[model samples]
Target: MKMVSYLVRHHLKMELRSLHNVMSLVIFALASTYTALQVLGGKPDPTTWNALAWIILMFTAFNSASRVLPEDLTAVRAYMHWTVPPRVMIIARTLHQSIIMIILSCLLLFALGLFLGSGNMDTLSIFGFLAGMILTAVGLASTLTLLSALSARAGAGYGLTAVLGLPLIIPIVMISTSFGTDLVTGVALGQTVQNLYYLGGLSIAIGIYGYILFPYLWRS
Candidate 1:
């Protein structure tokens, strides 16, 4: 537990120190939002707004995942292997990515609201939608972080992560989009509670899979 916390902190510190990476993601999200606004030529309907937000957040997650385990150099990996347990490292990385994705989700939401406008959502509905964003971020982060590890170990690069990650992440995106559409379109939170459960369940399930599978990948 202590080692996991230390590793998480280390990941956070490294991310904060790399100003370019942080700014790049922010720019990417804002640029994507601007492009969306231009393409639509105006504010989209509630469903479109929800889908666009999810799409931006999804790609942002991909961008973030591509940078996971930046210590891909053999010497650094060897040092990491000798010092930290693989399971602990995976947990820490997933936690770190989840934090990152959640923040990015917020940024994307804000950008979308600023440029494209949020749909007609009441306070409770907005809160429910925010919950969906958080759960989706965790699910995407866990799944992509695991795929990133697999891609790194295979020496196949970011393409492998995208190839392996996209199909697996569809269900998460679908559920989140559905829940979000409902919230934005004026469906009551109580009615869409099941989708939230599905999102949370998927996130936990993916994280557990990564936790169980990483040690073997690390050894290789």
Candidate 2:
């Protein structure tokens, strides 16, 4: 518990020092939202709105979460191996990134609402949208953290991160987007619940995989 707290604090401190990363993500969110508004031309249809919002959030999450593993893999590996258990390290980092992605998700949603105009949504739909974003963020953080480890091992840059991460992320985006679309369109209650269940199941599977597999990657 102490080790986990320490690593989480370390991540927080590092993020504080590097405020530029957060700023960049905000800027990207704004620019992307603005460009989307222009291209999509003033209050897009529900499908377009849902798709665009998810796309922006997806890329933003990718940019921020991909940095879970630093460029200098050897140094990070040595420090972590000497200092903490692999499970502790992975859990801390995943928790940290999950928080960051959730924030980004909120920001993206706010930007979308501002630029795209919240599009005929009611209270329940809004709640559903928020729920979807939270689940998506958790899923992204878990999957990307492990894939970031793999990308680090490959010694490639964000290119490899995208290559390896996108395959995993697409299914998430698909499911989440479908759920969001349903929410926007006022789908049946039973269908919405089913979508939520699928997302929950995927998140649990990814979390279990990361917890089990990250130790081997840490050793490598």
Candidate 3:
């Protein structure tokens, strides 16, 4: 627990030192939303709005996750390999990425609502969409963290993370989009509980795989 916390805090400290990178992500999300508004020439329909929002969020996840492993150089990785358990390292990275994704998701949601307008979303619907976003964030983070490690170990470019991660996250995106669309179109939360469960289950499954697989990847 202490090691995990220290690793998480180390991530936070590094992020704080790289404020411009964080700003770049925020700018990317806001700019994407604004571009959608300009291209559509006004507020889009609920379905269009939901789709655009998810696309931006998905790309943001990819962009942020692309650097997850490369930030640690060969020496840093060697040090960590000796000092930290592989499972602990993966857990920390996933948790850190999850925090980052959650914050970015919220900002993207606010940008979407501001530029494109969230159509017909009531309190329950809003809550459901928020829950879906959170779960999707976790799913993406957990899945991508391990992919980033693999890409690094293979000496592949960050783009490899996208190549490998996109196919895996298709189900996640589908579920989140469906749930978001339903919420945007005024479906009640109770009707969408199944989607939430599916998202949570998928995230847990991916996280477990990453936890189990990272040690082998980390060693080689």
Best by lDDT: 1
Displacement of residue 64 (Cα, Å) in model 2 is: 1.2
- lDDT tens digits by residue: candidate 3, 1-220: 9999999999888889987877888899999999999999999998898888789989999988876453368888878878899889999999999998999998888888888887668766776787888899999989988888888888887889999989999999999998888788777889878999999999999999889988899884
Candidate 3 displacement at residue 103 in angstroms: 0.5
Candidate 3 backbone collisions, by pair: none
TM-score of 1: 0.96
lDDT string for model 2 (1-220, tens) is: 8988888888878888988877898899899999999987899988888888888888888887666444236776777687788899888988888888888888888898999977567767776787788889889888988887777777686688888888878888889988888877878545687887788889889998899998888775
Q: What is the lDDT of residue 85 in candidate 1?
A: 86
lDDT of model 1 at residue 200? 98
Write the number of the candidate with greater lDDT, choosing between 1 and 3. Answer: 1
Query: By the TM-score metric, which is better: model 1 or model 2?
Result: 1
Cα lDDT, all candidates: 0.88, 0.82, 0.87
Candidate with better lDDT, 2 vs 3: 3
